[model samples]
Target: MKYNEIKNYLNGKFVSGMGEKYDVYAPINGEIIGEFKAATKAQLDEVVAKAKAAQESWAGLTAKSRSKVIYKYRELLMKYREELSVVNCEENGKSMEEAYAGVDKAIELTEFACSIPQLISGKTQDVSKGVNCKEERRPLGVVASITPFNFPVMVPHWTVPNAIALGNAIILKPSELTPISAMKMAELWEEAGLPEGIFNVVNGGKEIVEGICDNKDIVAVSFVGSTPVAEIVHKRGSANSKRVLALGGAKNHIVVMPDANKDAGSRDIISSAFGMSGQRCMAVSVMIGVGSIDEVYGEVVAKAKNMVPGVDLPPVISEAAIKKIEDYLDYAQENGAEIVVDGRKVKTDEGYFIGPSIIDWGNSKKMSSEEIFGPVLEIRSANTIAEAAAIQNESPYGNAAAIFTQNGRFVDEAIREFQAGMLGVNIGVPVPREPFSFGGIKDSKFGYGDITGVSSIDFWTNLIKITTKWNPEHKVDWMS
Candidate 1:
């Protein structure tokens, strides 16, 4: 009953997590903030049953009625933005500004979900004389979302609001490390008068994730995590014929052409590469210099060198994350690559902190290939645009790639040639806003469709085609 006691939410009330208890930490100080019992496998059936019961009435409501509830949720999200930001910062190691950005993104997605009444409508057409055909998108029943720790609030909101707004009941299984934001949002939903069982949150680790994937009643799943787990989720979820859209890790690349605005390129690469401490899937970890782009590279290094932890960068997620990044930096050292910034020396006594580190291209496989998932940026130089594009293509991840150039022809060429699902010309972080959609290609994402925006409509719903004839066709035709 105490605040910060993490629990599963069902029927508009806090249902205590009944599985193995896991300690939640405040990443900044590595302090035990709370504990959550992982939802047991035994709880899956009951959870699905509740979701089913709530979804029936929910689906029966007109789209307008659903929009009203979504509007209320959006209002509450905005009202509690500061409170949510605090929790997000405590658990996820994001700076207050970054935490606020996460909450704002969640609110933006909720606003997008509120427009479902208009965006989710079906199409009608006349196929034959005296016959009319139409298609309607129906809810996929009880569904689930497995979000990562990187963007706790925004990622959960990614699938939950959109799926539920379209009439499905959704179960949110947030990462155990950062369940506070989701649990807090669950409370907000209750206050917003969302019907019991319509929105649920099951807090836990991998077991609960497997429980979600294996639960027969859960017809669809949306997951955001590393590549290996994303592939597993997609495969396991698909084996059961479940609809799945799993977003995975990325080693995103940003190209800085010689003609690019030096100041803008410096600012953007630093923001994109080091923002959120480089944990996000859209974070650009690799920067490719096309031709003699030394000015921008030097400027980026100059700007990054002075970045103090807790101001310019959030604390690293955990000691484990710090070690992983350290190991990769060691790889650069072994390969004799110049460490331009040396993030290892930047430290704080109270928390896991790594300052922005820039390394000139190591020419090592792991340096160019693996996703370090920390604030380590690698600078690669290419002789031409084709070489730059090739460098990006060499990576297996096709999540996102950006090019900073003012020339329209180069921008157009980059768009066509870049081997990525999401491409940006001048923008560093190419995360598509609401209505535009966000996703990547190849190992970066699995299954079909983007995770948000209009593309998500298909992932969370089922389409039905209806045909009726008032009278028999006068003549036989292929349509008839």
Candidate 2:
């Protein structure tokens, strides 16, 4: 089941592609499971052409009809959920449970897109005389999605299904690390009667990514990656006047109040800090606590230390990532960051594992003010809740910030004062509902929201408004 041999989809058939090849490995065990063909520029161009050709008919379909295909695709995905989950786990190295959850989330997004037909319905407006007007969502010709590796299935599920349901032909460039699941899902979409090239998967690294972003045939580009990469893609794509939605990294924080229950805060912090091995963009990287709650905050540190890291929870995606985590931890310690918990020392069965890391954080020049994408949490002490909130607002990344408190007044104040894109009350991770938009302020996100909400549909399609006005007596030449 090598990735290259698996199939490169274009024009509806699984074709043996001619391109540079790379082997895909399971991050947990470091075993080569398959190979993937890096798409040649020629191949990408062909994909873009096919997508354009197919989009004409696909975009012409009524939103209701487009929604039906998405519905069928959702049904197919649901039926094969287990199989898809297994593939996701084996390749992405996430725990079996988390892998299954990711698949379900993708399914959930598909269902959300199913409801877009009504959500995207145009609004009518009245003009003077015998006039009626409306504005409707129109597909953006051909759109390209460049997804990340963290939640391989889930990320694409957020973009692809919605884009297709909105009547756009899609050319997807899934992460090279976990490309198999995406390719297989495209197969399932084909089974659901998607037209050839209506949904295409091209595998590659920067070449393919840049090609998709720069191609004029791709009317829009949607990206989910690091802030630097997102910035670059946004710049290049926008220079060409393509609609670009580039979501970047996040540095999330959780603030604990003196009056809050330490037990509850500990539990939430543990889950939010280490879930998916802290590979998520919304993972809590910093913890700020009022001085009065220092003892309670120590409990948070103790809990983070106790979390078991291994093949059971999925290792960081690659050896390179593990190394990066190591370098960051070393740098933090050298810069006076207290090593509360060292994940590098954690024991594991067979896979790449780092237990969890916690640092007594300070506002030193060397201590990171940005997001750390690993099982690491930094604890910062503040003299007052106001001081803690001030520190959080001063950080460069404003993706998500949460507060643990029983006081409605405090929660209200924090919500009103927080500078982050997402805010949480008692909740550690502040990811919004599927119907609500997900993005961040500052460096956390670029352009607009990515998935599962109105903003996402807007990202995939353009809105056009029509206004009509006519007086019966002044009406020009009726075709009788």
Candidate 3:
């Protein structure tokens, strides 16, 4: 499957778009690896119409039958894991290991969706005498997923499989920067014998997105992007009377108690801050050291300084990303923060790379609160555990927070008081497995549904209740 052959997958076939084609670049070497045609208005309309028509028969299928098709899709995904990883590495600027991990995560969600039969089961209870009520989940007519560029394949799978398996049609609008992976997944869906129009891929910028939002046929829209864009999507989609799940940005914080092991805590902190070049929403951006600021700071800076930029650490997504990170670096120094490990010294000619950086904000809460989205860690000191917890709770973004301590009481207190939607006791990135929901609170999320697990199923479907009563003797009284 060469990149040049990539086209919009519509109605179970590859269809050429009517608009101009744009070049797709490999982030690693800054070379044009392929090109994709932006879908036109007519093409988009046809795609939606086909999706609506195909969804009727798809929704008519039993859950058991749909699960079989999903199982086959998972099998194809596993068989093509290596090839998919290569594509992910080239376009996403992640290391080979991280690319493989992304594919593996996609596979995990696909496997989870295969259990839709059991997950979508209805419940029956007696509401009153001689009346029984049943609650069942049914798919929305048509749904659209707008994913970000960071985890291209995995994020789409976070929505696609669940929506389709539950009997809804899907229109996937992947990030223009990394649309190749979505095209590849569409090919795999065709190979798995999925019905035509059950899944469609549209590649474009804001026009396609606004079209999906305004289209009356699309019942729901799911989005993952920056907070500003997520808010706009949520507002526009909800204004159109559609269900929307818009997951936004985050500036996650990690707390290190005095009783925590310095070495272990540093390891977790380094991994969370630098992994994926700190582009992930759950990445730890702030470190709140309680009564152990000096010890934890020394340990974390020492380990981070030794990591090589492009070789040991992953590169940032694009040159623009690198410049954005550098701007943050310059701003921190200008604001009187002490630079511990500067990432500017680490440079590479082949790719957009930046080494891990640590900035000591020293009781000032200026740049420590923003989402840097790069491998720059800010250290903030707290006088006591209560103050540290307060600092974590006061942040407008309640995405993820972690507390490291050996004391059982402190761990318990942190778990209870932390305002984040996802909390970690010792783990740095405590994203739960496939069956659990993945999202944040406050400005970190806009809607009720998260991306993966049962939350995904719930988002793609609407609950329907049925109340039934049967009386054999009185059936023909009115007619007679």
Candidate 4:
């Protein structure tokens, strides 16, 4: 299907700015689907100014009123869910099933953000010395978000709607690779009668991004990408004193103990290892298990083999991603890691596809330290549960780690020892609900605030405490 030419969705309209428009190819078969404008610094400045203008009024509205607009947008999203899902799948190269879920999850995020009127309400505290003290959360005026390509819809949903619902005008910089879906979301907001400039979608690379981050009008910047790029953005944005939340790359792990249920662990491993083609920041790229569980490890390999590769999963984000996966596979093999399963030959005419592969990288140095964002996993065998836990702790990335076990003591011990920002006992990916915020630790995530749900409103806005007193008997008017 041919998609429309998407330019900058700026200030209530779509306009082609001064930049090269690149053709978006269908990853499966390398077909040119449509053209998208690469934004320039000028376009970004204009958008941010508009956002700042819009945010003034948006923030003036009550939290309930602002949330109503987001709620209406959520309804419109459901009404056109199928159309959006198709667009997501065709452009993103994910299987139809995964695309459907991504759309659904985005809708859920919008709805969740819409239900936070009470959560954003200011609080009051009783203080002595004849003073009434109160503190209230206020909108940060204008904010910016830079989302990754893996889950274009879901990642931004994790940022934008919450910011808008909490009364902050938002500027979103979606990945040029799959920017159409975000533009579609902008249209839905307009249809929901949202004020112009309250939400703007700018499509571009670094020039536009830096312009937005450095702009004084934009108060905060949220980003998700590789560790190196995230660090750069975080460093630069924070240098200007902008509130920045930059989510970096992760080498998440799933540890298995000898006492763990082998069947269940294998299932969780398969799902977490290959879900979304392992393009998610939360996907388990490494598996640390006790060496005594060799039979269970074999079971994991056999499960990976049964996965139909290209037919069952979406392709990696780009051709470069495919090359990275291939290079890592070869590199791991060359470094003495045993390839228990190889999905390199998987074929799909429509997208860049790779199936599922498992590598026993126990003997290979640095194999367990890398984050391969594809349908590949490295299994590291440890002599004991302590060794497995140590392997999980030694990784530089502490975004998330999962342990599978039935023992309460083991679960509690692992919980206390794992250095990850997020942990899952039996679950694979423990991305939290709207009430709980999502973030990572170490090099995985930057900044001091959470990006979504209630914390989003908290992060997008600052707090001010107010104190007042009225006493007629002791009225000493000091410019009262």
Candidate 5:
């Protein structure tokens, strides 16, 4: 693949302007593949102005018309799925299989967008004599979608498809680390018959984020990233009177009961902890074993030990991520934890490679509680299933949690007891698909609505209700 320098996609074209710039690297092999310039505040305002200008005409189209365009875009995405998957893998450093899955998931979100006409059909009711009320979904004008680098295609689709399907013009400020795939998608949107200025991509760092938050023309914001940044975006955007939904970091946990399916449960648990190199927000960080659950733990460790880097596990996103993950391993070891598998020493000569590291998490609550967005697994022991749940509940984040058990009572209890917005029973990664919605409770989510599925319709638009009384003369005082 030929690597090229990327620029801002503004007003239906790839354009560049003066601002802070950052270099983009391919983490798989440790090479500087490209550089992207941040959009200046003026450039940011220009794109927002363009979106504002386009939103009304776009919204004027019937819902079915909007859905048609979205469906076309989905088709275009599917046609180039392999190419996009390659770009995702090249830029984000996930395995080819994982990268393909990410792009496929993005396309799935677009498929969900194709059904927005039905979702926004609205409602009407006859309130009283000669009186009627109708409630309808109205587009929120210009909305900004801010995405993370982890899932190049998937994260943007979390809000973009839903927002655009609701008839809103979008300004996508993707992570500078992975701007190539986003810019490429802009081309596909144009090909799919989306109007000029209706969809735009502006790559930047902090200034562009502030631009998105503070710009009055932007009516809503969708953000996905670390907890600290998610909080900032939510507060700043809300302070500026824009609707905001921000998904943040998480330390997702899974509990293993004594009666759980030991062999199969352990394998799935290992996958949950190590898949995507454990970089996913939904990845299980801590596994709590209830009494006599050693079978599951032992099996999980056994399966994890055999993982081979660059083949079984992909590299982390950056050199800094390598150091960050290793620092955690060092800290854990120094704090009475055992490093069951030392990923700190990489066998691969090239790439930002790090194998899976398993920690016993003996006395380090810090290691178990913190969000280690890497292929690091921490294990702990608890006396009861409730005790294990209590340990998971201690986390400040509530993105997702899972339990492996045969008892219906335990599953039912976990459904009520787990604080996570997404839950799993005998499942590892329990991310909800379309129509089910995805978001978390507590610090995991900053705003009121989920970023995807049926629940997201409210976040991307506003409800407009019309009350009519053409002939309101109720002279009939006779009780019927």
Candidate 6:
């Protein structure tokens, strides 16, 4: 596909923008790959109107019919999995393997959406004599999905497939940094015979987001990004009387207990911290060494040192991200933290690269608690499991936490007390499969309803109860 061919899709057709176009560069080589036109306000309004018009017909279709279309979409996605991965790698700078994983995850969610017929079934009950009440789930007219640059394909799939399966028309505002992959997805949905305006891709930044949030036609909004931006989306969308599910940032921690296997636990920690260059929301940003600071620190640092930059590792999202990671490393050094393995020294003439970095905070609480969103791991020590749990719980972002302990009792306690939406006992990254809700608590998330699985179906639809009482009227003949 050429650069000019990458335009926004609206109402079942490729629409060229008369507005200003933004240049998109391949992060791998710093080459200009394409340009995307920003959708004007008028264009956005027109698409929303078309989507509102199409949503009624889409909802009118039987669940099985919707499932068939979703299945077809799954087929097309699988067929173009490699192509999509290539586009994702070029745009996002993740390794090919990670890109492939993103594509597979997207396909998995689409497959899950195909089973919406069974998932969306409501309930019935008899409330009183000759009266019965039944709950019905109906589609919200229009939904808008605002996804982040990282995991462009997977994050959008988190909401889009499920929303559409429940018969809601979607206006997708993918991260402007990685819009090509989403454009391809829209094209694939069109090829799968999805109705026009059922899925529209608009390319822009905050302006487009404001349009989606403030638009009365959009009944619901789904967003995944930084906590600050997530709060904005949630507040603005809710203020507009729209249902919002805003998944925010995470400061995930991995607690390595004294009884944990040193070698295996260290390897898992390295993988969790450096995978995708630590751009993932569930990535281990903090390692709480419980009662084994020296032992855990040595092993983790050794493993991290052997991680080769730009080969076993990948670059951060862009030049700006690389600078941000560097700034964080500088802060760590200034705060009396030992820079065990500095990734900023990696040699990359073209791409925005940063290898895995480790910082030993020497049991001090002076380290920054912000979500760095890079391959920088901070090591903190806790005297006991309770102290470690407190450190993990006190963070404002309660997205995910993991404990590497063989002791079943500790595992049980951690499961009970850890303040996170997702918990991993031995697993480093415990992201659930398709049929599960993926979200966090506290400042990590805003609004009700998660992105995927049953929560998605619930978010994209409204519930109503119907009560019926039928009485035979033989005495009505008196009126005749």
lDDT by residue (tens digit), candidate 1, 1-480: 123578888767787867888888877887888887887777766878888988999999988898888999999999999999998998898999999999999999999999988986889988887779999888889999999999999998889889989999999988988888888989898988899999988887788888888888899999999999999999999998898999898999998888999888889989998999999889999998878888998899899998988788888889999999898888888887788999999877788888888888634444558899999899887777888888898888999999999899888877788999989988999888889999999899999999999999988888899999875755566666
Residue-level lDDT of model 3, residues 1-480, one tens digit each, is 247845788888788777867777777777778888888877888899989999999999999999898999999999999999998988888899999999999999999999889987989986555567899988899899999999987899889999989999999999888988998899899999999999999988888889898999999999999998999999999999999999999988899988788888889999999999899999999998887556767888989989997777877888888898889999999999998999999877877787888998878877646688989898888887788888888788988999998899888878887888899988999898878989899999998968788878778888999888664445344421
Tell me how far the alpha carbon of residue 369 in candidate 1 is from the true structure, in angstroms, after superposition.
1.0
Q: For model 5, how does the per-residue alpha-carbon lDDT over 1-480 read when each residue is reduced to its tens digit?
A: 365668788878889757887888888898888887788999989888987888889999998988888999999999999999999998999888998899889988998999989878889987766677999998989999999989988998888888888999999998888898898889899899998888899888898899999999998999999999999999999999999999999999898889999877988898899898988899999988777787888888788778889889988888888888888988887888888888876546788888888888753465646688999988888777677778888999999999999999989887778889999988899999888899999889999978899999988878999988765566543321
lDDT of 2 by residue, 1-480 (tens): 444365578878776557778888887778888986787989889878977988999889898888878889989988999989988888888888998889888888888889988898778865545677899998888998899999889988778888899999988888888888877887799889888879988888988888987788898888888999989999999999888888888878788888888788888888888888889988888888765777567787777666776633568888777888888889888888889788888746566677788888665545677566888888787776787788788787878999998999888877877789889999988888788877888887667664557788878888898877665656443421
Per-model TM against the reference: 0.97, 0.95, 0.96, 0.95, 0.97, 0.96
Clashing pairs in 3: none
Candidate 6: worst-modelled 10 consecutive residues by lDDT: 471-480
Off by over 4 Å in 1: 1-4, 362-366, 472-480
C-alpha RMSD values across all candidates: 1.6, 2.8, 2.8, 2.3, 1.8, 3.1
- List lDDT for all candidates, in order: 0.87, 0.82, 0.88, 0.82, 0.87, 0.87
- Winner by lDDT between candidate 4 and candidate 1: 1
Instruction: Kindly report which residue stretches of model 3 are placed more than 4 angstroms away from their true locations once superposed.
Output: 472-480
For candidate 5, give the lDDT of residue 89: 92
For residue 42, what is the lDDT in candidate 4? 78
Q: Number of backbone collisions per candidate, in order?
A: 0, 4, 0, 5, 0, 0
Cα-lDDT of candidate 3: 0.88
Candidate 1: 10-residue stretch with minimal lDDT:
361-370
lDDT of 1 at 96: 92
Which pairs of residues have clashing backbones in candidate 4? Answer: 27-351, 28-350, 28-351, 29-350, 309-355
